[model samples]
Target: MEIAIIKYNAGNTQSVLFALQRLGYKAVVTDDKKILSNADKVIFPGVGNAGAAMQSLQLTGLDKLIPALTQPVLGVCVGMQLLCNYSEEANTNCLGIINTSVKKFVSATKKIPHMGWNTIYNFNSILLDGVKQHEFVYYVHSYYAALCNASIATTDYILPYSAMLQQDNFYGVQFHAEKSAKAGDKILLNFLQLT
Candidate 1:
């Protein structure tokens, strides 16, 4: 399979690549528009500021290219936030693929950057095929896509938020599937199996 991991200023592409390698799949990391467009599946993985990541995508015209992709596209962490119409982070406008907004976790008691393992449930799509209800997945983010019509999976930290989102051929995961171990692997494998 021709899988492509979208390379941007945001980090964590290596981890995603490594995970895919473990799954017996090889993926090319590139920001080149043509290379991304031709891939059978595209993984947009990020672990950085939303504004900066969007800036990098904009610089290479990937901001425009990404939303128009016809093939299946997967976004991880900040990559998922970028799929939204806007984000509270840096007051940035996002890819607008998913009909939702990314917001900061407002909890006076709970910690910021809701890190560590959390359970995800309410699987509403094929993306969570083998991932059982309340399965643990690694997460490290303060911002989250709100519970919207596109939310296929839900996770609770400060509140119930989108653990996974799907809109047409686009999919987004708030958790870091690469670091989530077996459950994460299943989610990644399921995404790859998508036609």
Candidate 2:
């Protein structure tokens, strides 16, 4: 199947490409609207500042093109945050595919950027199919999407937040599945097999 990785100014696309390669899938990284829309699956992965990333998406018109995708679309890291309604990262507006807002991690002792591996709990989605609850995933973000009706999985840093979100064909994960090891691979494979 053809998988298109939305190419923007965001980092981490290469790692995602590598991960897909490991899964025996060849994915193209492009900003072309037709290429993205026609793909069997689309993956939006990012690891950068929210405001600047949005600007990049706007430049390529990908900001508008992504939400219009009919097939299964997976958003990773900041890519996931962008799928929400808005983010406090830079007081920026987002795609609004999911009715949620991103907020900074409020911590009195722990650091702002909740870096390193963390366990994701309360899993309940097709993406989590074959993946156990409380599975450890790699995460590196300061801001997180709040738990809402669309939330499929939740994680805790200072409090419980939406770790994974599912709304129809749209799916998003706060952690970097490309870097999350075996469980991450299963999640991607599950998405790939979605009807």
RMSD of every candidate to native, in Å, equals: 0.7, 0.8
Query: Against the true structure, what is each candidate's TM-score?
Result: 0.98, 0.98
TM-score of 1: 0.98
lDDT of candidate 1 at residue 109, scale 0 to 100: 97
Candidate 1 residue-wise lDDT, 34-112, digit = tens: 9899999999998889999889888989999999999999999999999999999999999999999999999889999
For candidate 2, what's the RMSD?
0.8
What tens-digit string does per-residue lDDT give for candidate 2 at 59-94?
888888888899999999999999999999889899
Clashing residue pairs found in predicted model 1: none
- Looking at model 2, the pairs that clash are none
- How far in Å is the alpha carbon of 34 misplaced in model 1? 1.0
lDDT, candidates in the order shown: 0.93, 0.91
Model 1 off-target regions past 4 Å?
none
Segments of candidate 2 deviating more than 4 angstroms: none
Quote the positional error of residue 129 for candidate 1 in Å: 1.1
